[model samples]
Target chain A: GAGVSQSPSNKVTEKGKDVELRCDPISGHTALYWYRQRLGQGLEFLIYFQGNSAPDKSGLPSDRFSAERTGESVSTLTIQRTQQEDSAVYLCASSLARVPYNEQFFGPGTRLTVL
Target chain B: AQSVAQPEDQVNVAEGNPLTVKCTYSVSGNPYLFWYVQYPNRGLQFLLKYITGDNLVKGSYGFEAEFNKSQTSFHLKKPSALVSDSALYFCAVKRDDKIIFGKGTRLHILP
Candidate 1:
């Protein structure tokens, strides 16, 4: 589709398991971002991938959360040893670039339920 | 640090009447403001943004926002409210290349 797309719209996993979320950004977009939204809370920045340079992983919650982008294209967010606290809607967004003025297009998101 | 605030958790308005959703922000440098709306079980849709042009920025769905640098506010406004306009609204501010969002405000348009 023209907009950003995320796989496994909903996922339920057992505690201590591992899960991966995928994101396909809009065609030609040079920047990608990952964010998590907890119930009744605002969006929390997770990571940002800009071109081929090192991703901005500053917002990652913990060491268990890691993400990688393949040549400025599709990106995947991996969660190791999933915990109940990890349950949330993981959102993916993409933009033309990292400029503040750039408008980001968001994907439907994957709702992860770690029980 | 950079942050955005939407004071009201929800705002109720009558159909055809003017509406306003308040938003305030703080950042280290010149602020980059934005408004996004989300419908049920859907991702946020971009509404309007304030970069460097006029204080009032018009966006999709006939929505508009005014950037008040002196007041540190960027309030979303619409001349006529529609029931379809009811949704969750988020205000954001960009600082140091990070875009921070507010808690969000839920708008309900009474028919």
Candidate 2:
């Protein structure tokens, strides 16, 4: 089975420009999550979606960061008015579900560089 | 509120020797602990998780972790080290609906 996949392995953009990163979760994964990893740093939770329930937006660092998922499939993390601080590798993950402690499968990630 | 800490930024061990990567976590209730590894230029891969039951949990690549409730720690250990095992390791804890990861520890296996 194919693991999670993210598009545009590398993206370089000017500051203040908006960028959208895409993620394709496994075929039947009902839960998806987004995280940011700066250089030599840990993973920072961004957002997550579970089935039909409302998405968890608590981890979004700021209003400029937002994500949307259609059903249990694809998800997109959009960073508006990107800043140099936003430059990092954006990773996406998926799991069977959030309950009972299912380990998440991660994607290769999209490295976003705000120049 | 919930957090995880990997005390050492890096650990170096000789091949064929034993290795240990320490992890500690803080949460309100029973914690769901996990270990993940990231090889260079690759995505993170789940190693093992401690949900309940036995304190010693075995995972991939001959790796294992012990869950110590009293100490509030879940340290990843391996009896024998392999050069291939060198990479960045992350300690994570599941909190409510989200998972919080530690700053990660880099492992170097000297061959």
Candidate 3:
């Protein structure tokens, strides 16, 4: 089966510009997640969506970051007025369900560089 | 707040020798622990997880992790190390609806 896929493997943009990163979860995965990995740093939780429930937005660092999932399939993370600090690899993951025990499958990630 | 910690930033071990990457987590309620590996230029892959039951949980590529509730730790261990095992290992804990990841430990297997 195809793993999670992210669009635009790499993106370079001017500061203050808006960028949207897309993610396609596995065929039936109901739980999708977004994370940011700064250079030489660990994964930073961004947001999560599970089935039809409300998306968990607690991890979003600021109001400039937001995500939307059109069901259980595709998700798009958008950064408005990007800053140099927003430059990082944005990773997406998905699992079969929302259970804590289910292991997540990750995508190659989209590296966003804000100039 | 819930969080995960990897005390050592890097660990170097000789090939064929045992290796251990320490991870501890803090979260309310029963902890759901997991270990994931990221090879150079690749996405993160799930290694193993400790949900409940036995303390010793076996995972991919001959890797295993022991869940120590008393110590609030879930250390990833392998009896024998391989050069290919050299990569970034992240320890994570499921909190509420999201999984919080640690800073990651870089493993170097010296031949």
Candidate 4:
């Protein structure tokens, strides 16, 4: 696709259930990022993947949250034991070359609602 | 830690009037400032960025932002506002591989 795409546009999960959100970045883009937008709050960085380098997980809120990207193509974000606080929109973005000035292309986002 | 701040929760402007959304940042190294806009039920779209040379950066949708190093601000501006321009605006600063975003400001364009 010409732009970044995300799957499961909306998800409703139980408190104890686990969920996975998917992201397909722009073809050949080297940098992919995940962020969470909570109600009444800003976009919080989740994780970042730049090519073959180690994915930066510093912004991840907890151990239950994890994400993986394969060969700069598709990425999946998994959350275990879904909590009410985890309900938010998960956004994904990708940039052309991971350079300093490059702007990111964003997906429509996956809205997760935990019940 | 890197941080971004949008002091105003909402800004209202009349249609055809000029508008400005203020943003400020705190980062360790040089700042890579950016502005993004979000329509309801949609993801954020990049507006413009200030990476280096010029302090004034123009972006999509006739939006422009000025970068001030001393004040650490990257304020987004538009010469005219339209009813369709009403949306949420976010200011961000890139630190390392991640970008820190402000709380966002809701722009209301009154007719």
Candidate 5:
């Protein structure tokens, strides 16, 4: 079975430019999550979508960050007016939302570098 | 707030020796501890987890973790280290449907 996958493996963008990173979760995964990994830092939870419930946006760092998931399959993390501080690897993961303590399967990640 | 801590930024051990990467976490309810490994230029791979039952949880590649409730620690361990095991290790805790990961520890197995 295919694992989680992300598109635009690397992106170098100018400060203030908006970038959209895509993710494809494994088939039938009802729970999708986005995280940011700054260089030499831990994973920062961004947002999460579980089934039809409202998305959890509390972890989102700022207004510049937002995400959308079409149904339960694909998700996109968008950063508007990106800043140098936003440079990092954005990772996507998915799991069976109904199961307790289910392990998350991660995507290769999209590295974003802002100049 | 739920959070995790990896005290050591890096650890180096010779091959065939025991390896331990320490992690401690704080959560409101019963803790669900998990360990993950990330190779260079790769995504995170789930290692093992401690939801309940035995304190010693075995995982992939002969790795295991010990969940110490009193200490609030879940440290990854392997009896015999391998050079191939050199990578970034993360300790995470699941709470309220959100997972929190610690500042990962870099493990360097010197052969």
Candidate 6:
């Protein structure tokens, strides 16, 4: 793909429902990252995946948020028992590799609205 | 933990005038700085980055940033502003293999 792509650009789910957001990073990128942006707030780190290494999950806000990446390719962010507070834009990014500092390309983002 | 700060919530500039969006960072070891811009209802676009070497780095859309190691700052600047340049800008730092982003500053260029 020319750039990172995210599915379900906008989603509206009822409270307590489980929702999954999908992301397809740029082909050949070895690092993938997930972030959340609440209204009028900055982007908060969620998770990171680097090749075959164990993912860094330190940024996950709580047990309800989890994510997985397959072979440095596509990734999925799943929210369990979604709450109205969970409503926000979920962003996915990818980099060539997880070095000291690498340029990350970002997707448009999925607007998750928990009604 | 590493973090970035974009002090201003918003900045307004007139077309053809110089513009600046302030940014400061905290990190361990050297910093890998970056600037990104976001348009309404769109994804973020990378403007430029400063990895190492020269203090000044240039990037897409005629944007540039100056890396001040002493000051721990990397502010985005443009010689002349355009109305089309109105957007949200973010400053980020790469530390310990993790990229941390700032709150972001909304920039408005008045025509």
Best-performing candidate as measured by DockQ: 3
The DockQ values of the predictions, listed in order, are 0.75, 0.77, 0.86, 0.76, 0.73, 0.69
Q: Candidate 5, residue A83: CA error in Å? A: 0.8
TM-score of chain A of each: 0.98, 0.97, 0.98, 0.96, 0.97, 0.97
Give native contacts recovered, as a fraction, per prediction. 0.55, 0.74, 0.86, 0.76, 0.76, 0.64
Clash-forming residue pairs, model 3? none
What do the candidate models score in CA lDDT, each in turn? Answer: 0.93, 0.95, 0.96, 0.91, 0.93, 0.91
Would candidate 5 be rated incorrect, acceptable, medium or high by CAPRI criteria?
Answer: medium
B22-90, model 4: which lDDT tens digit per residue?
A: 998998788898899999877789998888889999999999999989998899999999999899999
lDDT per residue as tens, model 5, B24-71: 998877889899999987899999999999999999999999999899
For residues A1-115, could you state the per-residue lDDT of candidate 6 as single tens digits? Answer: 5899999899999999999999999999999999999988888989999999999999899999999888978999999999999999999999899854568899999999999
Which residue pairs show collisions in model 2? none
Instruction: Report the lDDT tens digits of candidate 3 across residue range A37-115.
Output: 9999999999899999999899899999999999888999999999999999999999999858689999999999999
- What is the two-chain DockQ of model 4? 0.76
Q: Is candidate 2 or candidate 6 better by DockQ?
A: 2
Q: What are the runs in model 2 whose C-alpha is more than 4 Å off?
A: none
The digit string of per-residue lDDT tens for model 1 on B15-80 reads 999999999998867889999998998899999899898999999999999999999999999999
Worst 10 residues of 4 chain A by lDDT: A96-105
Chain B TM-scores across candidates: 0.96, 0.98, 0.98, 0.95, 0.96, 0.96
Cα misplacement distance, residue A11 of candidate 3 (Å): 0.3
Candidate 2 lDDT score relative to the true structure: 0.95
